[model samples]
Target chain A: MTDITALSEEQILEKLLGGNEIVFEQVFNKYHSSMQSVAYAIAGPIIADEVVQEAWVSALKALPKFEGRSSLKSWLIRIVANEAKTRRRKENRSVSLEAIQDSWSTDPRFSENSQWKNPSSQWHGDTPEELLSAEELKNCIEKSMLKLPENQLAALRLRDSGGLSMDELCNILEVSSSNVRVLLHRARDKVLKVIDHFQITGEC
Target chain B: MLPNCKQMAELASKNLDTPLTGMAWLKRKIHMLMCKHCSRYSDQIKLSSKTVSTLDLDLPINEDVKKNVEKTYQELHCRKDVSQ
Candidate 1:
């Protein structure tokens, strides 16, 4: 079996254009999740799969004209993001940034003077790998992530998992850079809190 | 002015996406030197961010959708070949 992961971008493009089924499957498996994440972030869960399917169709149709301007993964992600946005508009579902509450102002971790009222305790696991080793903690994190506000979840998914640039994130989420930062921060903070609680108590 | 603990927490999260620089960077460093709690908080957020990035959140693609996409690809490829 050829190592598709080892192939260069140009090589992958060639294989894809040549209609290599194996390469196509490999590529699909590699990016399908990230594409779905972007789609879910924009279009919501109900139509996210539909948006990704549409994105794949569009990407395949336009594959011949791919100029290699951005990475193949990035191009595909942008396609899904656009498809999800259009679908969202059609469904009359707007992801309102204003709906996100600014919890930082009233966070319980800090004191009235902005000092640490309840500081974080030492964790048994320091690295991400170590923390994720516990299956329950992983589930807890995922659950917390799913419960985050729509825009915040979208920002985190795009920036962290999708590996999109800040500019791309702003463009996709249709928010200012500062607003993107807030969304990203809130999402990450929730994850941090989840892990912290899990570490301290060993329960979800 | 030095950023308080709340501001430091925000900076730490922002630093993960875009590195803090100039005064912000210097201030975070200075504050970390004095406040162990904020330092730990920053480190924890960084760890969580790393974990989130590494998560495999991809739900499996439906088999029917997979087949349809493959079929569409083949039809497109044939059309291109005929045109060439």
Candidate 2:
């Protein structure tokens, strides 16, 4: 059994194609969660796993032609994203533009002037180490993240957590680069407000 | 002209993704130097975004799924190898 953790893209590709079960398993575990997130974003949670499964099959078939143009992870994620989009279209589920717009306008946090009506309070003990150490706060942040509007959550997940570039985000979400920037800003603002509220009141 | 606190906050959030450039960049720096609230908001939001990104929210892929994928891959590849 090969320890595929430290392998480069070229090496990993070679081992995976060489019928190494351990290498295959390691690769699957490494990316399944991120792919699941992309799938869920595009197709919703019910069929997210199905989309990921299909993506794996698609990637496996296309492996022989997998050019090293992009990192292996990026290539695989793009496949998952596209697969999920196809599934979403088939299911006839789409996020309405009106919903996204309404959420932005009716956001109670902002004033008519688009400034924070009740500006965010300073957070206490919010260092990265402190954040990780505060299990309750961590849980609070995660819950708030889940509650965010779908598009905002998806944008945040792909850019920040999935480590995708803005260009890739624009391509996946079918939006322009400036739109991607605004989406990310709005997403981060919502998350920050959650943290602020949590810090001030000790409630999520 | 320099941006106000409201606009400053938005710019600060945007700055996380892309740097402020040209005159707007200079203005933001000067404004943050003077406005304590916006400065704190800027710092806190950057920290908040970083912390939130580090949160483990990915949907779990359990052992069953992994095993299934592995088995499927092997079957597909093995068949292909034999055919070729």
Q: RMSD in angstroms, all models?
A: 2.6, 3.6
Query: Which stretch of 10 consecutive residues in model 2 chain A shows the poorest summed lDDT?
Result: A95-104
Candidate 1 clash pair list: none
Error of 2 at A143 (Å): 1.9
How accurate locally is residue A144 in candidate 1, as Cα lDDT from 0 to 100? 84
Q: In candidate 2, how many Å is residue A105 off? A: 5.3
Instruction: Give one digit per residue, the lDDT tens place, for model 2 in A1-204.
Output: 578767789999988777777788788877787777778777898998888888898999898899888778778878888788788889998743333454655667667866557767866665866865767778777777777766777788777766677877877777777777677777788788777887788877
Predicted chain A of model 2: TM-score relative to the true chain A? Answer: 0.76
**Winner by lDDT:** 1
Tens-place lDDT digits, model 1, residues A1-204: 656889999999888888788888888888888788778878999888888899999999999999988888778888888888889889988878874566678889999999999888899887888888899999898888778887888888777776789998887777889988889988998998898898789998
All candidates' lDDT scores? 0.85, 0.77
User: In DockQ terms, which candidate is top?
Assistant: 1
Instruction: Give the per-residue Cα lDDT of candidate 1 at A106.
Output: 88
Q: What is the lDDT of residue A94 in candidate 1?
A: 80
